[model samples]
Target: MALIDCIVLALYLIGTLAVGLHYAGRNQRSQDMFAAGGQSPWWVSGLSSFMTLKSAGTFVVWGGLAYREGVVAIAITTCIGVSAILVGLFVAGQWRRTGVTTPAEFVELRFGRAAVQLYTWAMMAVRIVSTGVALYAVAVMLVALVPLEPGHPLRDPASGHLSLAFAIFLFGAIVVAYTVAGGLWAVLMTDVLQFIVLQLAVLFVIPLLWLKLGSGAPLAPLPPNFFSPTSDQYTWWFMAGWVGVHFFLIGAEWAFAQRYICVPSDTDAKKSAYLFGGLYLISPALWLTPPILFRMLQADADPEQAYILASKLVLPAGMLGLMMAAMFSATASAISGQINVFAGVLTEQFYRRVFRPGASERNLVAAGRWFALLIGAALVAVALLVPVMGGAERIVLTLTGMLFGPLMAPTIWGLLSGRIGMAAVTASAGLVFLAGLWVKFGLDGPLGSPVLAAWVQANPRIADVLVGAVLPVAILTVAHLLRRTPQPAWRALQARVDAYAPTPPDEHGVDHAPAKVVAISLGASGLLTLALLAFNRDGRGALLVFGLSMLAIAWMAWRVSRRRPGPAN
Candidate 1:
């Protein structure tokens, strides 16, 4: 890496910390810290939610598939878009109508406090462990790419790369500091900034690679099946199952539920989800292009590293730093969202609701910050221990997938059907848990028959869908039908949802502060990029185009902040 690239990377990290500190004073109440006081614009929530899913895994995992199997990666990712749309239509508005601050609150109202306690502990464990695994994965990827000077204190002796432990700690500390200090407001704003950086960085790669491959039939030599929508390994059934898995995830998962809850009204919640879906639908063409093009350039290159290698081959000195920053942005966006969501649950669900019912809002906010610190510490510790855990990450991932049905089915079903009482929820979850164990252990474990295990190995995606989505949903439906009676809690909760009406848009007006912050940050990034024209003579056009794009979006944000709403009908 060049000195210019290092400077850009350092500045981006510092900017994230500055954003956190900037919003530290905004939380006079717990609502302000955790849910933006329900004042965040729908667009901000939408963009933040999208960034939460756009992690470094997108590049490492999907990019490898793009290199080896062309358009199939795009199809797999587009499943999330389909899920988002379905969720918006059926689920997002329901969350807002409930008027709950957290998903745990809704769970308690429908299933009793016992369910809340069960879900809080169980989901927190799953989220923390899974996030640690994600952090560890990204750090390992970074250490392979980032080299250190000979005999440098932080360099690995054998690899001459940055130490894996240092990479994990460094990125972990950055995420923790911002989330603990600034809360959800910090997470939202940083997400917007990171999205811009990531989009611009990848957007630049397309033009550079295109210009380099001037006038050639670059894709002619590739296999004919490379362009097929469904590869042999990722077939049509797998795609359908993949879609179902994400539907349960995006429709009812706590992180996404928080996005729906934090918006101003049910309408805003729907709009936010729609925006997320639209982005996923439109973005794959741009995000996956570089790796596909790079496959033609270097057919023998390591598929997992194809995306980063493409950037290194084509991007200029300072811009390579921006690309590296974008990679960090991917992981940071995800980890920060998880930290903030769990912190909110610990504060609102456990601390205030159970331990101190009469605690002041100030105290609740303080407790939230403390909880954030604790969860962040735990995440770092787990990430640092991943190497010694020996396939523990894979185990944790499988466990999380298995639990999704038990966890999400009850919550989503409760929203739509009053017939699904706590008894059904408990029964379905127990049955589903046992069924998941059978699938994972009885069919695929070492003790299982080799023939069955081999089939599961070849079609793991279909098995996951059956165990995680199809079976739990079936159990819940059957148990609810057997009950045939609505609980009093469901009736009262349904009454609240039906009777609630949001404040009129004209009366509530818009909160322009977030838009203003976004505009200023984007403008600064644009001006900085434009200034780099003084140094890079060879890449003047790419810098000019990207800088102008940033400024254009910044102007749009400023316009949003200044605009006033008309009177409502």
Candidate 2:
């Protein structure tokens, strides 16, 4: 990397740390520490949710698919948007109205304490794996960008492991620093910056690539079946199954569910979901443009490296650094979001609830911070093993699919229906896990069953869809029938919900919702991004504009934070 590029990247890292530290001491109570005291504006939470959904895997994996398969990949990717719409319509408002701090708390409300405890631990494990996969993906991208010699120590089999481990830890440590310092406030604020950076990077690439490759001149001919839906590994049936998996995944995913609880009102929660859906709807164009262009130009390029290779080919020195920052931003946003929620679960669902019910607010806040560090470290360790696990994106999808599959039916059912008992829900979860494991791994372990393995192998995709969607619903239905217990009425549930209403931090007289500051930051950042796009001809000019814009946004944000109340206020 050039000296200018390294400086740009270093500045981004410094800015992220400063933002987190800027809000570090403001969280006086557990609520403020965990969910920003439930005062986050809908738009901020919405942008955070969108960025959380977009991990570095989205860039590497989905871009690879688009490069290999063509526009059909866009249709498959839209499942995320469709799922977001479904969540906004049905789940978001209900989550906010429940008044729970974490999704596991909602499990306690809807089911029982035992169920919530089980769920909290289960979700923590799932998130750790998911975040680890994200870390690994980003580390892979970073290593790819490094100009390693053929026999470099970092590329040697023995020392390459050390290099990979170092990359994972480096990424993890940076994310944990900000997350532990500011909690959700820092996470959301930095996420807004990350979202802007990532969006601008991709948007800039599109026009530049177009002008460079496919200007007014005639484009090169596409490969055979480039425009066909059934051209590649993604058949219509496969796409349908992908949609089915995400439909349930999005509705019950803990990350987005946590966002629903971060807002002041149910309306705000719903609006965030809607905003998330809208962004998902349009994000494909920005995300897929470079890869699509790559497909048309260099037909033989490695599919998974489409976006990275495009950056190398199209972006100049400073702009390439910005794109690298964008990649780091994607992974960091995801890791921070997961770590924040993990800390919440640790403090609220486990630490305070079980170990120290009488712990002070200060003690609990301290515990949450410690847990964030612990969990972040654990995820880094897991990421070290991801290189041997085939592909980072594939591992994430398969693991999350199996883990979240069974939980989805019970979660959605428990929220909407009031008649299901805790026992039934818990049992359904166990059965669904066994079923999903059989379909996913096919009894390849000590408990391997030859017959089941053969069946799974013969119809892998079909079995996946059945286990992920059909089997869970079936188990839930049977459980509901076998245990015909009437749950508490919705009125009673609402009463329980109201009891957990957020306590505003007005005694300090701090305006938690600084709408004006958010507006100024976003408006300034957006205008600056436009300026970079317009001034693309001069690399130095674009770099100068990006730097000044970041400085201006940071100054405005710092000023707003100074007005907010502190611990002693």
Q: Which residue pairs of candidate 2 clash?
A: none
Error of 1 at 501 (Å): 1.9
- What candidate 2 gets wrong by more than 4 Å, as runs, is 148-162, 215-223, 229-241, 441-459, 481-485, 488-492, 497-569
Which ten-residue region of model 1 has the weakest summed lDDT?
A: 391-400
**For candidate 1, lDDT tens digit of each residue in 1-569?**
67787788888889889999999998999888888878777888999989988776677767877988898889888888988988899999999999888888899899998888878887788777767766776776677667898989999998899898898998889999999899999999899889888988998999899887774645535656877789766788877776777777787889889999988889999999999998988888789989888887778877766788888888877888788788888888888998998899889888987799999998998899899989988988888876576533344436545777677878888988888877777776677778777766787566577887788788666676677778888888787777778878889998889897763544636677787888888898888788778778788988999889999999998998787754432
Cα error of candidate 1 at position 10, Å: 1.1
Deviation of model 2 at 35, angstroms: 1.4
Q: List the residue pairs that clash in candidate 1.
A: none
**Model 1 bad stretches (over 4 Å):** 215-224, 385-401, 444-451, 503-508, 564-569
User: Tens digit of lDDT per residue, candidate 2, span 366-402?
Assistant: 9999999999999998888876777776776566555
Could you tell me how far off, in angstroms, the CA of residue 429 lies in candidate 2 after the best superposition?
2.3
